[model samples]
Target: MALVAAAVTYLLVPLVRVFALRIGAAPEIRERDVHTVRTPRLGGLAMYAGMLAGLFVASRLEHIGAKLADPRVGDGQTVIALALAGGVIVLTGFLDDWWGMDALIKLGGQIAAAGLLVAFNVTLLWIPLPNGGTVSLDSTLRTIITILVVVVSINAVNFVDGLDGLAAGIVCIAALATFAWTIALTENLEQGRLSVTAAITAILIGMCLGFLPHNFHPAKIFMGDTGAMLIGLLLATSVVTVTGTVNYDIAHREINRFPVVLPILLPLAVMVLPLADLIMAVVRRTSYGKSPFAPDRGHLHHRLLQIGHSHRRTVLIMYAWTFLFAATVVGLSVGGVPLIVFPLVVLFALVVLMMMGLPLWRSGRGGRGSGGSHSARRGPAPGSGPTTEDPSVPGAAASPHAPATTG
Candidate 1:
């Protein structure tokens, strides 16, 4: 399924780029914009198509099909809900990409998408607590919690999309982490070869992998709002599914757990970067008496740049942080690494990375060098470097004349 999704998305991106250019659908460059040209966006549509292809194939395979045939994962409800909700976000994102959208409307789309899943019973059945206790939520609470997760996750991805390959790479790492935990958990429980969370995560991971070649620094295309929100929704769906049918009681008794909260915590730990970014953004925006949706260049990535890190270096740094945090949590949870050595290893790695970046810091402090970033001087290749469809502002537009941003 993953290979299928990756291949399909990889093949579809260039075609989508051409379509975007021919239609003249691109964002206007704005302040803090880095790309020299307003490249075409909506590559997300291609990603969506790729993921759907994977799902289509999975529905037919006897092993995966059997899982999908079960009511919680299959019975046509959960899968259909994911597809329809994803379609809704894709349409909303497409509209935002072509002509921009009100932040409220974009949020509404996210809510509706999440609500669609809840209506189909694709929601958190309960939350696990640290003491091995379970907090069973009522229907009303479940609905509210699920919608909140959807909204937060959507915005988190959108906020982190400032760098080319940044959001995609981060999300891919998250899915990989999630897949690791899910697959391990199911295996520990002797629950066949795959779980719904693991299966969907496989497809999502493939989507990101396929999209990355085109989205990497010196990117050929941007996923825009369409892709960011779509991936966010898919990620939340994967997390939510874990809580639905898993016999937590059995698992609780089954595995030699670490913190007992790891199941509920591991995915969030994997997503710490985006979630932390979202929280900081809200606090930062609101502190200035602005709406939480207000746009600014104070994001974490921006801070890295402010400190003189090159665009590419800043992105790589963020990836390392994400991987370290995620890997440590998973390692401890699965008992794959000694807990005592984990922190020591992380400290050593951080020291090394920080030391290597010292030259960039000194150069940036003196205003003499800024990672020698030439992104502002370089133009996108013909039919590449898509304009960002940003929803950071309440009513951000895709101005064709504006220079392209790092997106």
Candidate 2:
């Protein structure tokens, strides 16, 4: 299924690019943009198409096909729900990429998409308390929590989509981790069936793998809002699918030995990077008395760029941080590492911090002027392109002088 999605997305991109250009969907360079050319967006459409093809193929498979179609065991409606919900996200992203959208309107679309999932019975059915107790949620509360999860997830991916390949790669890593965590959890529970959650994450990972080549630095195309939000929906669904199946009695055991709520923690850990960026972006803008969705170059990626990393290097650094953090948490969740591994992780973290700060250390007196966080005041680094705001569709408060740009 993953391979099918990859090949389809890979082949469909050029055609999507042409169609975007014909429709004038290619956004012009903006004040906060990283790319120089008017690159066509709506790559999410291709991804969506590829995903559909994958799902269709998956439904015909002998292994997962049985699981998906078994009404009593697995809710086949989830597959339909994912498809319909993805359509909503793609359409919303398409409009934003074409002419931008009002932040509120875009948010409504996200809620609507999430509502589709909840209607299909994809929801958080229970919560595990720390004291080995569990609380089952009524439909109303579950629906609200599920929607919040979907919205927060969509915006988190949107927040991290500041650089080429950043969102796709991060989410791919996340989906991959969820896949591993799901399999481990399922095995531990002795549920021999190929779980819906595992399958969903597999599809997501494949779609991202297919999209990454086009989105990488010096990228040929950008995934834009459509792609970011669609993948976010899928990633969240991967988490929500298994939230109910975790036996609290089993999971709650040895809470001190390993994380008891790994099903929840794994996704949160995977999202820590993007979510952190999202929170900071909101706080930063609100503190300035601007809309929380206002576009700015204060994202974690933007800071990496500001610190004198090349566009490519900045992207690589972000990727490294994401892998380190997610893998560390996953290792803890799975629970077979040597005690020395923790110390090694710390050593790795210190090395990462050193790398993160290396340019500042190397530049000494001269580097001070160009390091990031001061890009707005100092301008771009020597010979570097002018810095720009993110202008993401979720909440890009455009300059009064320029048309709204949700590229």
Candidate 3:
């Protein structure tokens, strides 16, 4: 399913790019932007196409498609609702990317889309209790919680989409982790099955991987709000589908030592990085008497650039952190503290340390002539290229501003 979705998404991107150009969806270079070019946005249109293709293919497969045909299971309906909600978000994003909308209006649109999900019975019904029990939510409470989850997840991904491939890569890692956990549960628990959650996640991963080539450092195009918001909606839907509907009692029985808190912790663990960034951005902006929605260069990725990591390295570093965080949490849930897990944890920590220290180490060996001092002094600027002290290093470099190009 992932492979099929990837192929479809990859093939559709060129077409989407052309459409974006025709529709004037290119974004002007901004001070906070790392890309020096006015790249076409609305890449989410291709992602949406790929998602449809993936789901269509899944609907025909015997094993996976069974859930779609089974009237007793709500997975089929959930998939439809997810697609509908996703379409709403993509439209909102497309509009914002093409002509821009006020932040409050965008928020209202997001909430409306979230409400659609609740109306489709995609909201949480019950939560697992730590003492081998379950607590159910009343209709009113469920609606509020569902909307909040959808909104938060949407904004979290949106907030982290500051660099090329950042949001896509992080979400891909998260989706991959989630699929693994879901598959494990399906296998171990008798009541568990391959449902909309697993299918949606697989498609999500494919969409990101397919779009990543164009979105990587020195990007040829951007996903803009369209792609970012779409990805967020899909991710939030998958999390809700799995966390809200999973048989926690069966999960507890199968993995006795698994934390009873896994229902809540699992989603948070998968999304820890973006959530952290989102929370910090809000706090930081509010502290300075600025709107939380106001854009800035103080994002985690921006800080990585500040620390002298090149564009590619900064992206890779973020990927590393995301993988480490997701894997550790998933590992803990699936297997409680296995021997090999500790060594793997140490290795990841060491890798992070090495990446963080690489610039300093190279600078020390090559001296100030290495270009490190120059890049460091260049500081953060919008539309500025990455600063690499070493000329040999391939990083974003400040370039002369070209005349703004329109699609």
Candidate closer to the true structure by TM-score (higher is better), 1 or 3? 1
Q: After superposition, how far is residue 145 of candidate 1 from its true place, in Å?
A: 0.9
lDDT of 2 by residue, 1-407 (tens): 88988889989988998898899877666655433576677788889988898888887888777666655322557678888999998899889877778888888899999999888778888766545466788989989999998888888887777677888998988988778877776666566343677778888888899998987866677787889889989988877777644555665553332344556766776677777667776787777777775666666665555555666777787778778877786777677443345446555754774578575547742233433233333433221222344434222222211112222
Clashing pairs in 3: 31-382, 371-389, 372-389, 386-396
C-alpha local distance difference test of each model: 0.71, 0.71, 0.69
At residue 384, candidate 1 shows an lDDT of: 32
TM-score, cand. 2 vs. native: 0.85
Query: Could you tell me which 10 consecutive residues in candidate 3 have the lowest summed lDDT?
Result: 398-407
Query: Model 1, 1-407: lDDT tens per residue?
Result: 89999999999999999988787667555653445676778889999998899888887888776776668643446567778899999998888877767777777888888888888888887888655678999989999998987777777777778777888898888888888877777777877634677778999999999999998877788887889889988888888877775777778897654433555665566566666666886686677676666565556665555455666777898888778777767767677443355446556655755575577566555122443333222322222333333345221222212111112
Q: Model 3, 70-173: lDDT tens per residue?
A: 54334447657767888888888888877878787788779988998888777767676655677788989889998998888887787777667888899999
Question: Residue 324 CA error for candidate 2 (Å)?
Answer: 1.2
Q: Give the Å error, residue 396, model 2.
A: 14
Best by lDDT: 1
After TM-score superposition, what is the CA distance of residue 137 in candidate 1 from its true location, in Å?
1.5
Q: Which ten residues in a row have the lowest lDDT in candidate 2?
A: 395-404
Q: Give each prediction's root-mean-square deviation over alpha carbons.
A: 5.0, 5.0, 6.2
User: Candidate 3 has what TM-score?
Assistant: 0.83
Ten contiguous residues with the weakest lDDT in model 1: 398-407
